[model samples]
Target: MIIKPRTRGFICTTAHPQGCAAQVRQQIDYVRKQPAIQGPRNALVIGASAGYGLAARIAAAFGASANTIGVYRPGERSGGRTASAGWYNSAAFETAAQEAGLKSFSLTGDAFTDETKARAVELIRKELGQVDLVIYSVATARRTNPRTGETSTSVLKPIGQSYTNKTVNFHDGEVSMVTLEPASEEEIQGTVDVMGGDDWQMWIDALREGGVLAPNATTISYSYIGPELTQAIYRQGSIGRAKDHLEATAKQLHEQLASGGGRAYVTVGKALVTQSSSAIPVVPLYISALYKVMKEKGIHEGCIEQMYRLFADRLYSPNANEVPVDEEGRIRIDDWEMREDVQREVAEIWGRIETSNIYELTDLEGYRREFFQLFGFETDDIDYEADVDPSVEVPNVSA
Candidate 1:
């Protein structure tokens, strides 16, 4: 099979195995060249297959020399259909980790279930004994409660009145107006249930109970608080409400583990092209404009760069005893993206952006390329026309 990107709206249905391997290698190479991190020796990364989660796993393994176990849900190739991009990504990552003599394992299933959690705990107890760092970066629209077996679905909508904003069709660079109606209370709660911190707390509690969480361990989860331009659709929206729950959970977890010198934090990250972000209304356009401004200023960063910085500069720096954080006790790695100068330029671009001048004013082309690249397409040196195998195995998958 010759795998190529097949898209329907924001979803990519096909992924190239070699291209995904190349993408993983690029991040690994970048991490290997940087100064080694004096961080965790054993780590567990939930949702460690794509986007920021994958980058965190790479940084922990290659940058800090940690043995890692990854939990993700990815479809494998079957019946002539290609595997999900995350599948290929995990396979590549585990292969590279083993080649480098670093212990790595992948467990594929619903991370929200008790069975999966129990299996992960068992793996940790048997293999690594104690994990010093836990990274929770799960992003999904739906979650099933392990306690109740009830499923909740998250929605991307504002909480109050309808929101009208300028958006772009990255497929064609067409800038237009999009109005998203407010979510109902039930819907907002549903979003919180799915995207909130309950599952993270459950994971931590299980790990601690299983005696696999190392003393003075640290746990981090990812979040986003974009500029005011995207407030209505993002920060002030239903997802924002979920983020509030997540941040609150961090505080609770921090207190729970405080007696042992353990810590929990919500790291607010920068905006970039992600499968989850692409689904939110008006964000793609904002990111396009943001990319243009940040690139011109030479401060643009993708997932790998941001994760590496989080580890090297903030988490494990020479002065890491006092990790830099904001008033709310959350790490603000999005500081550069939320810089005043960057926002000012993005605002100016927003005011004058139209379909006729979208390509001129924003980095829509770059956005499109990166968007495709998420599905293992648009990569450098890959012959998309060549025949390839769709069934690539994740060599270290367990349970």
Candidate 2:
């Protein structure tokens, strides 16, 4: 059975195994070409199959040469349907890591559950003993409570009032105004439950109890703070409230990790095209404009580059005992994305942009390409027309 790219709404329903492997290889090659990082020796990356999570895993294995355990939920082959992009990505990642003589493993299951957590800890104990770094980069719409069997689905609506903004259908380059209603109190809380740092703290507690975290271990979760253009629907919206809780949990967890001289922080990352980010309203448009400006300025950084920088500069600074942080005790890698000149130009384009000139005025074409790349389509060198097996094994994981 051959596989190709298919789409439904913001999600690509099909993925190419070879294409995904190529993408992972590109990222690994980039990391290998750079100087090695004096960072974590052992790492665990939750949600480690796509976007920032996947990049974190690659950075840890290739950049830091860290033994890594990546925990993610990936779709397996069903009949003729293709496996998810992450499945192939993890497969490629595990194979590459092993070839590089880096110790790494891949676990597939819901990271929000007690059983999955236990399984991960068991792997960490048996495979790597303990991990010095944990990267929490989960981006999902829903989660189920393992203890209560309660299911919570998160919404990306505004908090207090309705939000109306410019949005784009990246597929057709259609730009239009989109209005999102405010979220209910319950919905807001549910978003917090899923996206907040509760699970992060739980992971820490479980690792601590299982003695799977090394002394002076450091953990970081990714967040974002876009400009005022997206403030109402992002930084100041329902997701923002969830991020606030996540950020606040970092402080609490930091104190808890103090016993082992460890630290916890939330690092705000730049907006980029991803399976998760493409679903967020208004962000695609904002990112399209921002990408155009940043690319012209020659400062565009994708997930791989951002994770490389985070590991090389801030997370593993010469002063290992103290990582550089903001006044609020968070790391800011969105510095370039949030530059005054970039934001100023993005805002200008955001105000007067339209569908007729979207291609010329903004990087909508680039955004579209990245969107396709997320699902293993539009790759430069892959023979998308070739016949390929839908069932590609993640070398480190039994499938």
Candidate 3:
């Protein structure tokens, strides 16, 4: 059957397998061109199907020749309908990894649950022995606690006050002023529970207890801190409180790993248009402006570029002097993207932006293109009319 993008609001119901394969190929090629890094040889990546998680898996596999275990929630794909992008992405990645003569396995389930963790540990112990690095890059709106059987949802709102700002709908490139109501105390707490460090801590503790983490192991989680334009909706918002918990969890993880010369660090990555980011209010406008400025300055990076730099430059670089870190031992690559100069310039252009001048003032067009491309929607190389197989199988998709 011919595959094309089928969308329902923030998510696409279908994905193009060939296009997803092409995307994985492109990322692998990019990683191969860079200088080699002596990174991990065995890795575990949670949320390892899309966004930063997928990029991290690609970088580790291609750049460092690491064997990886990817854990993600699987989506339905049957009949002539295409699967979710993450499902196709995992299939494409595993195919590529096998062709490269590297070991890779993908598991689809709730990563926050004990049963999934046990299955992962058994696989790792049987196949890879121990993992030298673990990357946690999950970004979800809701989580059902495995222990308590309770479901929690996260919100994207500011902490102290209501925030009003100009936002854009990227779908139609319409600019409008919007006001976001303050998050209730329950909302705040729920957001923290869902997006916070508890799940991360659970993963680390399980890996540690299972004796699957190798000595001198390194663990990293993805975080974000955008410019003031998005502070109300992003940083300093309910999500920000969750990030604070995540960052603090890193400290505890660091202590746990210290005995083995291991370390845990949070890498605050730059904002990019992912499936998760597109749903947030007011972020499309900020991302549009940021992309225009960053591109003009020749500093724009996609997920692959960001993850590559995170590993080669920050994590695996032999020279400690070259590694960038915050005063708290966390990496702040997003801060570099949200520099004062860049924000000032973006604000100037943002103030002048209207529906008439949005394309000229910001990269709204580029942002929209990227958003669609995430689901293998608008790629020039893909022939949407061609008969494609929807029954593609990941090499090792454990139940």
Candidate 1, residues 1-399: lDDT per residue as tens digits? 877787888898899998889999999999999999998999999999999999999999999999999999957887879998999999999999999999999999999999989999999998999999999999999999988889899999997899999988889887789999999999999999999999999999999999999979999998899989899878899999999999999999999999999999999999989999999989999999999999999999999999999999998887766889899999989999999999999999999999999999999999999999888999999999999989989987974
Candidate 1 regions with alpha-carbon error over 4 angstroms: none
Compose the digit string of candidate 2's lDDT tens values, residues 348-380.
888889999999999999998888888788888
Q: Quote the positional error of residue 17 for candidate 2 in Å.
A: 0.6
Q: What's the true lDDT of residue 18 in model 3? A: 80
| RMSD list, candidates in order | 0.8, 1.2, 1.4
Put the candidates in lDDT order, highest first: 1, 2, 3
**Which ranking of candidates, highest TM-score first?**
1, 2, 3
Best by lDDT: 1
Worst 10 residues of 3 by lDDT: 75-84
The model with the greatest TM-score is: 1
lDDT tens string, model 3, 1-399? 877666776677778878877887888899999988799999999999999999999999999999999999986486657777888889989998989999999989988789999999999999999999999988899988888998889998888899988888787888888888899999998898889899999998898899898978999997887777788788799999999899999989989899999999999999899999988888888888899999998889999999998988789877774457888778977865878888899889878999999999999999998888888878778888888877778888896
Clashes of 3: 0
